[model samples]
Target: MTMTIAFAGTPTIDDAPGIDWREQAACRNHPEPNLWFPVGINDPCDDAKDICVNHCPVRETCGLVANRTRERHAVMAGFRCSDPDEFIDLRIWLGVENPARRTRTCRHCGVKFSTRHPRRRACPECRDLVPLEPVHRHIQHLRNVGKYTLRGIAAASGVSVGTVSLLAKGQSPYEGPYVSRAIAARLFAVTTEQEAKTA
Candidate 1:
């Protein structure tokens, strides 16, 4: 029998201070234990946003927090989920206010990412994740090349400070399988050995 493995990707946890699952359950008249669990792509009905809209005294603040964090990934109140496609939709509808596009791809998985900062190596989801050896090699390249400063690398790569920081620090860059392979190859090809031998 060919068994398929499924892993949860999205961050649906409500870790905001002064807000708990119990409060959400009470607000929505749902069971406490059930609401506490993280919602996946399958559980579409878990309208946590509606709970925020109705129960949260700081409704606007809550929405702002959710929006700012880019955490709301599905029917958040009346607002659609904050998926990558949704962001694209929002950008099309409301206009991408931020000049920077903080999206990235993962070397391990083909999934895409939408972060506050651009990624240099791997996506946030892939950071520290035990996967392939090439990913490690890629991160090491960033460090050896004095790409430690996130903001500096971001400016240079046109990626993002967050991404550069993650890559330099040995963390995953983003989600989609879109590593800057061309750049990495070029950088790696010009090894220190060649430079020293030339001198």
Candidate 2:
């Protein structure tokens, strides 16, 4: 995750000056704590987004803090942070990224991104998540040779459905061109049932 200087000028926890808002978090006592710290696709933690985005009363605060800290891990207020810009994007959406920062919707991901550069079209994360041909080949292999459904592959591989869909672009199971290096490695490592049986 790209690190960035944060908390430079933002509101922290509202309960107590600098106190964290974890206590009031809807996921405070969630059965699966690992949902927030999902590592790559091994534990997609898809439900974490719902909790952070919908159920949590402090979702706005959560997004603010995540942006303020430039956190790259976990689901913060429904935004999957893959880069410093995502956090900044959230801050920008909240109208607090920076005094001088202007917001633009990422052409690739469609998320509002904070930018001082006029030519920037996609968010930092979306820009870095360019698709790879090899990964697309693997997707084809999963569907054709392995007889694996996209959902099945996602559940088995611990990769998020969105990641798989992103790689697929829009043509069903493989069309677009945007998968991050981390996603590529995770997807490349996934094996079809045929290969598994042979092994």
Candidate 3:
């Protein structure tokens, strides 16, 4: 696959006539491109994350580009290149640090679409139909009954701390009105007391 990644100086092949978000990328002109790719290993896990999470304004767009072009294991998005076969294997791919795009069928409408998120199983309109109250109730149970903090729940549930925070606030910032079924399953599966570390 020919990927025209508009990273700093690189020319993009699919200039679909919009503002170039790449210019705002924090990794622009970095000394080592592998600091982001690290296709050989998964060690660039920390500092790079700081750049994307703290500085990059176009982090979402960058991941979208990577997913759109199928950049073949490149860590254009926040996905860690830790596992050697991250490109070939999907099982090793985990939560929170999710980025990049892949094609998935919506479980609700049976519509196929491109998504950069691993948890997005339904289209936006159908996403609301997925019950989120159960997930929130479980989260509350974990917090109130189990005495776990939001961060603790985030760690155990494989969901982001920000997502957990939003859910507590009766908001779903990353998702529509609900989290994906996969995410819900993940939250429900966190019965381990230790995994749900106390704050």
For all predictions, the C-alpha RMSD in Å is 14.7, 11.2, 14.5
Ranking of all predicted structures according to lDDT, beginning with the best and ending with the worst: 2, 3, 1
lDDT of 3 by residue, 80-162 (tens): 43432333223223232456778988764456978765566666544433456787788888887779899998887767787
**TM-score per candidate, chains pooled:** 0.24, 0.44, 0.36
In model 1, how large is the Cα lDDT of residue 182? 39
Deviation in Å, model 2, residue 150 alpha carbon: 23
For model 2, how many clashes?
Answer: 3
What shift in Å separates residue 149 of candidate 1 from its native position after superposition? 61
Which candidate tops TM-score? Answer: 2
Ranking by TM-score: 2, 3, 1
Candidate 1 error regions (>4 Å)? 1-38, 72-82, 85-199
Tell me, by lDDT, which candidate is best. 2
Model 2 clash pairs?
Answer: 41-158, 131-177, 131-178
Once model 1 is optimally superposed onto the true structure by TM-score, how far is the C-alpha of residue 74 displaced, in angstroms? 8.4
Clashes of each: 14, 3, 1
